[model samples]
Target: MQNPPLNEILIGDCREVMKTLPENYISACITDPPYNYEFIGHKWDNSEIQRRIEKVSGKGNKTLVKNIPYGSGLAGGVRNKKWYQRNRHNILDYEKWCFEWGEQLFRICKPGATVLVFNSTRTVAHVQVSLENAGFYARDMLVYKRSSGIPKGVNIKQQLEKKGYEQPEKWDGWHSCLRNEWEAICVLQKPLSNNYLETLLEYGTGLFYAKEQFGGFQSNILEGIQRDKTEDFNVHCTVKPISLMRKLVEIFVPRLENSILIDPFTGSGTTLLAAKELGINYVGVEIVPDYLEIINKRLDGISGLQGMLPLSE
Candidate 1:
């Protein structure tokens, strides 16, 4: 395979792109694949609607997690049995999609390599199960607790009152779901060929650096108080904070000279940028050409990273 180029974003679908890489080429993976749920803010107007339409569906640049149309029964229009059935079907499809790339990832990473996948708290279990089915072991689930989050669920009492239902007060203060404060990080690992120490000696993997940046041990729950610094150069709607990505990379990625970290769904190139900032090697795959350009721009702007990257720095 001649070894895919390092520290660069490959512009193609990860499922196909990863197949071309040599087996066991990557040491660790830190990625946030599509959540497969189609959505936009409900409080948007015509102008915002048009912008989102152009961003996700225009020009055939639909390689995003929200590839499914907004009004599809699968994506929540009415809460009928048909909608539930459609949603379940899409959920299954999403799990299948996860496995397709996860299998390739399992083949490309060394035994004992870790994969940290950020996804919706509701669906992270599906991601874990799909990767486990693809020959990786589910290790632990990490939580990223945000300082604030929007409550996107529908208010039950308001809807009932609008419908003139009897005793809408019965559903006072009720909503469909909780506030979207925390997200799930599905921690997965390729099975080791030997004991942890032996695998560490042989493959330079099979363990994590447990030391925390703030001091003491690394906890499963990651609390972030820093504001997003990607706002300067990033247009990706779901750009993770550079602080979060760097911490994940520091803990899960090995420091061996030849070791490489990868982000199969390198949205806005945050993972690659984090790895580079830490003197680690990285390779990335982004299916969207528009985002690939954005990634290159972000990477090229790395010289100002200490000021323009994470709010922490």
Candidate 2:
């Protein structure tokens, strides 16, 4: 595996592919990994909670919100002591899984390289902690605000009424959780080589790109990112907005020659396409072959792209 070809999507487990890569070869890592919730039968999301959800949702199609299915850890079940314990154990497993790949990412990233991970708001902290344990320094979290949200939280009032509790009408406005309107983007950087200045000079990393002269000042809060409604939802369950991905690529990946970006879980090749659109080289790994078809179709649809090849700058 002598520097497996760039600007191509590899078909396999990212953890294994990353393990074979040379150390410090990657300039940045941007990925939206499985959120451990058994999201729509993703094989990687094999959590204890998923089994519980299946039992609750049965074999029927669960109610979906936007692209996210509603059959959560509860799928509308009581959060009793046993449930809490099981959920906690699932979270521990999720964190360990994060560390498993985080270590590989840390190994492959150049010193001072950036890593931006998109995760659910509820579990972002666990991912942050896992990355910290994997030797990446925690920086800050970015918020991607959506125009609308999925009200997936269980309705306590409905539950109370079903339980035949007294005066359930009194809790009309009460609910277990708020509407999910945003996602967490964990910002982290590999340990700098000496200092920021030194690292920037040595590896063209350890810094964020502003270029304020060409655009407005950046903010941690990214607002109003919407998906392409025209996208075929059947192709992939969670296809990220191209605008959002391009914004992220522009900021995180430098345009230096041979600079490479890797998205270990390239669900639909959004990051790779975004990198290609910005003239940055990239490599990706996708576990599902069907999704490789989606990635290829999406990449081929690019105005001047062909055969997963990089566009000349």
Candidate 3:
């Protein structure tokens, strides 16, 4: 409630931690929390796999798993014992948990505040319903186009053929199956008694630079920074690029100089780091202790940030 000592991470459950904060304390909330999908938890190393990539052939190629932070990956295999337990039972359980948090978030944010929630196709509809029920109006959906890279050594098609499976002669985009190239970013706002669109439009129009760079930005969706993040722990859980958040804040809330940006489920604190870099104040809440530590270390590494006890110069 006492602002939790600026630039420091609060390591605890968001719902409980949020209770210590004042009502309408933040100007905006941007986050990508756990979706109910029970996403696989390990990264796939396809370096030894074969590929027939054509579209991205001319582009600067980088290995999909290279340079990514360790400990983050997809969900699959029995090794994900802990994940299986946490996400067992009915699918609705996950959605219910999200709704509970959504309500809490709505209560803490200022009126006319913006909340950006990122989710997958499997859970986007449920998230939409949850946000609406929480009293926030659905504003836009931003889409980030990604390029899935190929592995180096093994022959996946050949392996399938050898197994007597029907393998297609040509491979289409990743999404033709279950592989996703873009994620849905649901934007919501706590409406003002009067016209809310004035501020909404002002925020939307401000993202023109990113719109122009990534083509035109859409109210419901927009393109994202193209990169492979399967190896990055902070990015492994269907995370949105910091670049995207940077653009969104820069365009929609240019005067963050005096506003507080809150991310209740601050996984790796990407939003917090972005806000500090942009000279905007921020408060974050994370359910995992290690994640909070990661954010603290990240903030300490930021040189321009002041009025905080940074671990490093």
Number of the top lDDT candidate: 1
Q: What tens-digit string does per-residue lDDT give for candidate 1 at 1-313? A: 6647888788888899998889988889999987757322222223443555676665654433333445554544768888788778877888888999999999999989999999888889889999999999999999999898766678999999999999999999999888788889999999997789777777778898898657899899999547576556565667788888888887898666767899998878988888877777789998766677778887776752222111111
Clashes of 3: 21
Report the C-alpha displacement of residue 98, candidate 3, in angstroms: 0.8
Winning model by TM-score: 1
Give the TM-score (vs. native) of candidate 3.
0.65
Q: How close to the true structure is residue 127 of candidate 2, measured as C-alpha lDDT? A: 95
Tens-digit lDDT string for candidate 3 (155-245): 5556556678764334222222344567677878876535555543332211222445458654445554654353343432334566777
Backbone clashes in model 1: 0
Quantify all predictions' global Cα lDDT against the true fold: 0.79, 0.78, 0.60
Cα displacement (angstroms), candidate 3, residue 77, comes to 11
Clashing pairs in 2: none
Estimate the TM-score of every prediction: 0.85, 0.84, 0.65
- TM-score of candidate 1 relative to the true fold: 0.85
Tell how far residue 293 is off in model 1, in angstroms.
2.3
Clashing residue pairs found in predicted model 1: none
RMSD of 3: 9.8
lDDT of model 3, residue 261: 78
